[model samples]
Target: MRLNKVVLMAGCAMAIGLGAVSARACEIKIGATGPMSGAATQWGLAIKGAADFVAAEVREAGGLKVGDETCQLKVVTIDAKYTAEGGAAAANNFVSQGVKFVLGPMGSPEVTGMKPITTRNKILMFSDSYARDAIGKRWPLTFHMGPGPAAWGDPIVKMAKEEFGIRKALTIAPNDQAGTDVAEVVAQVYENNGIPTKLEYYQRGTTNFAPIVTRIMAANPDVVDTVSTPPGDAGIIVKQLRQAGFKGAIGRLGGPGTEEITRIAGGLDVLKDFYWFEPVFIDDNVRALQKRYHELVGVEAPENNFFFLFVAGGRALAEAISNAGTYQDAEAVAQSLRELHVNDPNLGQGKWIGEKTYGIRQELSLPFGMGLIRNGETLPVRRSDAPTDE
Candidate 1:
């Protein structure tokens, strides 16, 4: 039996039941594995909700058009609990369930553990993790959804140089490979810009940051950069830094979870001297998407990095499948994804950009906004291109 061809006609979808492919639409499942519980639970929840939001939007558009077949997308999410072991188990379960495409296993460590299983199963993967070292030749089937560390670091360096006249930096991050990678990128970017940098590692899950804050004060750097610290930890660091009498600039070198971090730090007041990078402008267009997201999910969208990235990434994937005219062909979808120029409600204007570093045109090119929290609101101070090593 030939598959029915699905097409969008006059702003609606119709499945032509004229072929061996039945008119009855099939469901295409996209699996998401992440830390649904544990320290990173909020990140997991937001990403999952964003994926669902994308699915809901696609469904509202009368289902996804895949060549001649109209398919409905269903997101199947598994909790990885923010650990390598848990991620492996989740990937194994996904493989068993015959899930071909997966949304995320948020952390690089989690991806490292899950990659073997996902690869064995030939699953196409998308993630918000910015660990660039984890992508590239080794992981052929996986793609990094948003800007990585270099993307974050380069813009901050440009902003610091132009606006703050910053010359030195001190970085604090969780003691892990992700942290190490982020610190390395920022340090290199800063050093190349003629700014000396130092890095400090903290054990994950530490709440009282008094000692860390004291050490940071002693360093007396011009900028204190948090390298991929969780929202809660970033809050503590920011608050404690202020309390410890440090009056210098601060930068969130990773994708900053703005809302969550500000809330945890007691409000936007605590983020007064902070600067971070956002992939898109949160103008009226993006705000409308956030409103739609809240209405669909029954929760206010977190103004975090991955919230927008996941929504945009999910939409991009769907578009790729439609353009490739196949829901089951991962490589075709991957190729299509690279060629897309995205201008969605959530993502603004973007194009896939990383050909030199990853050896594939995979990274999304967008003007990253340098944001600052001032007078109780977060606003864009400047906008610049994401770091791409040509």
Candidate 2:
């Protein structure tokens, strides 16, 4: 009797082990890589939050349907630290784990670092970098999360000129590819709009901007634009600019971080004359998206508005994975993504653009907003249509 009982128990244990293995086999892992530490941590967190929320949504609906099997969606995140080496390391980590899809590596340096690895490993990536070559025909598996300043800079520059009557502008950014690429584009736009502009660069990781502020004040620019500067650094520049009594309109013709900038510079009153590019105009639909995130993910979403953009991208990726019927086959998934209509329930209609600029139509073009603060009073964001080749 004892020998029979031992035999039955051994069989049950083996069956349980097999069941666990089967369960793991059905899990689909997606990676979220970005600068999860330092000044740009907010952007990385937004990417992670979007991935987690999408995974939660899939799990709530009984997992993602791929062919006949319902596969579990899992998000694996790594901190790229806003560096080239960090981004490459993150990609290698994903490759080792058999993760075929990745969400971000938010900076230009990070994107530059990860591109070769992602392409070589056949990992499909959706990056939110403002680099000139962020999306190209060379990396067909990579897609842009949103259009860079090349699309929206002109409109914002025109608005600033009209509102603030700025004649001369000085743009400041870190002395690196990430900063120069965006600053040059924005400076061109300002000049196109009849505003003479000067380009200034500071070494990265410089905490004190008093020297830079002194140079800017010496130039006596009617407006100062912080293009592609991290929010933490930009805030210090703004505070010192104000302290030095250099009262000119301040513009962020780069990524949206008005809230953080405002906080770091003290408050809205300190950002007396400010304008920026808001990736999404918050409305009822956007608010509903945030509420859904809280309900599904059980926490408040990241404060940066970039969260919405990542959410839209994440949903599209999930849909493509389901339609492709195989997450392991990233090429098939990329093809399906290329055919997908850029429509998010919350963000509404968008389209793929960037053919004229990047030689590929892989960039996501969505409605954007121009934010303003004049005389220390905040104004509602004004919406603009998505940019086209025209």
Best by lDDT: 2
> What is the C-alpha lDDT profile of model 2 across 19-124, one tens digit per residue?
6422334678989989899988888998999899888877666667677566667899999988888998999999999999999878999999999999999999
* Model 2 steric clash total: 0
TM-score of 1: 0.87
**What does candidate 1's lDDT look like per residue over 31-87, in tens digits?**
877778765777787678778887777665667778666677788999987667887
Weakest ten-residue segment in model 2 by summed lDDT: 1-10
Residue 35, candidate 1: how far off, in angstroms? 2.7
Candidate 2 error regions (>4 Å): 1-25
Predict model 2's lDDT versus the native: 0.87
List the global CA lDDT of all models. 0.74, 0.87
Worst 10 residues of 1 by lDDT: 1-10
Candidate with top TM-score is: 2
Q: Deviation in angstroms for 67 in model 1? A: 3.0
After superposition, candidate 1 runs with Cα above 4 Å error: 1-25, 295-299, 374-381, 385-389
In candidate 1, list every pair of residues with a backbone clash: 2-20, 2-21, 3-21, 4-21, 4-68, 5-68, 6-68
